[model samples]
Target: MGVAWPFADRNEGFREGLELALDEINRQGVLGSRIRLIEKDDKSSVTDGLTIAQAFANNSELTAVIGHRSSAVAVPASKVYDHAGLLLLAPSSTAPGLTAAGVDRVFRLIPDDTQIGSTMAAYAHAKRFNNVAIFYANDEYGRGLANAFEDEAKAVGMQTVDRLTDYKDLNDLRRIVAKWKLLGCDAVFVAEVMPDGAKFVSDLRKAGMKVPVIGGDGLDAAALADTAGGAAEDTVVASIFNPFAANEAVRHFVRSYEDKYNEAPRKWAAQGYDSLKLLAYALEQAGSREPSKLAEALKRTKSWQGASGPHSFDGSGDVRDMPIILKQVKDGAFQYLTEGARANE
Candidate 1:
């Protein structure tokens, strides 16, 4: 197992989840062989991820690779894994292109950003926010999410006023706010990771823009509240799991996570746990460590209950029929709003 993250110090949730997963694998004896985890810090760089993935691929002992938290890194790192014929399971890389990257060994536990974008679009349409502006990171994850949201919003008769793409510089945000204001957008959607999303919201609010801001799962981290301060209050984000779901399974996972970590498990942690659990199921079913056989077993998974929800893959090797939750930020925290089923339904 290889745990990849952009910054070694920043991704505490992922680190914690990786620890829990390793302990669980040992405790449950899920794999017939003793599983060992190899941790790699991609430093949130695509080049670093690719290099580390190549190094892991060269190692014969590693049966599977478990993470590359950021989609930007995961997208390129996937090529390395594909060339090496190593199975890779991502806990939270939700970029859309991953499904069609022509990599048979790559799989993800969380629904792609496209799924979140569609859900947010439905929520926006339901609320009558017909004219919206979009601010997205100029990366694979952000671009993919923005595209999906735009398609769904258009399908529902919403008008896209402005689409601004940003990278690296914080000063570019002022220009985006001005553009959105000029377009007379009723609502604004931001597609970026927590750090970028926080800065975008903070900058938007500083510019005295008061439109309701919405975002994808990238803004689902607790750090967003700290980074955006009051700006994040009342902001809405869409994600795969709702901690407040009525299911007993979800409640149990929440309690277990809180008991273990003394804090609420973020969506990242939940996805990590779910990803490992899914892998364990496939390993048990396949009864072998062979990558091809394990991949086949993964495809056949059905009704497998996870911390997030019941997950099963579709023909594209993506989770099928998953439910998305629209969550609103209230009192500096993310609160559940409503649930939407997959678009195919």
Candidate 2:
């Protein structure tokens, strides 16, 4: 297996998640031999990701990969893996375009941007947010999510008051916030990754915009509340995994992860762990490490339970009917939100 990710300060949870799963799988010796993970750091850069993909493709021994957290990287890198006939399992890249090309061997563990963004729009509409502003990064993940939310918002009869990208600095952010205030925006949807997403939340509060803040999985990080401080309070996000889930697998993962890492696993970790678990299942089903067989086995997956949730791939290699839930930042942690009660447990 070839594992690649940026491995940046805030992104280490993803690597930890993969490592934990790798350790468990290797201990079981499921393949009748130890699984050796060939790791690389893509730095979340498209150029670096493509370079790494080509290198991974060159390695004839490598049958599969779990990597490239950013869609900007994964979208392009996936083409390389597809042509090489290697299984590319994306743990976090939610851009629809990642699998839209019908790549034979590419699969995504999480629900695509459309599912996440539409869920947010539905939640916003349920909250009676008549008009909303969108703040997104100028990249594949951001643009895809923003467009999806806008489409759903329009369908829900909620107007998108303003949509802006690439705010250069705090001054620029405040200017955008002022414009949103003038536009009578009642909610803000952020489509950015951590540090950037955290900064936006902090700046939005500094700018004194008290309107609701909603975001996709990009903002659902352990570092979100830590980086944004009290500003992160009440921020709502669409998340893939609920850490507080009562499922035995979830509870076991949480306990084992905490025991090993001395901390709770984030959504990225759960997805990463699922990627490996699902891949192991594919390997078992195929009974061969051959790339084509593994790809076919993966395509046939249905309701494979993991710490994250049930994963069933569609014809396009996109996870089918993956659960997307609403979570709120409360007391410096993301708690699952109960719809009617609006209560955090």
**Each candidate's lDDT (Cα)?**
0.80, 0.87
List model 1 lDDT by residue over 1-345, tens digit each: 766775455675666665676677778686556567778788888788888999999999877888787888888888788788888887777887777866787787788877888888988998899789998998888898999999999999999998877534545666666777787788999898878789888888877779899998888777788789998988988777777777876777778788889987777677777777678788999998888788888888887887788888875678866777777777877667765322210
RMSD to truth, every model: 3.9, 2.3
The runs of at least 3 residues in candidate 1 whose Cα sits more than 4 Å from the true structure, single-residue gaps closed, are 167-179, 339-345
Measured on C-alpha atoms, candidate 2 has an lDDT of 0.87
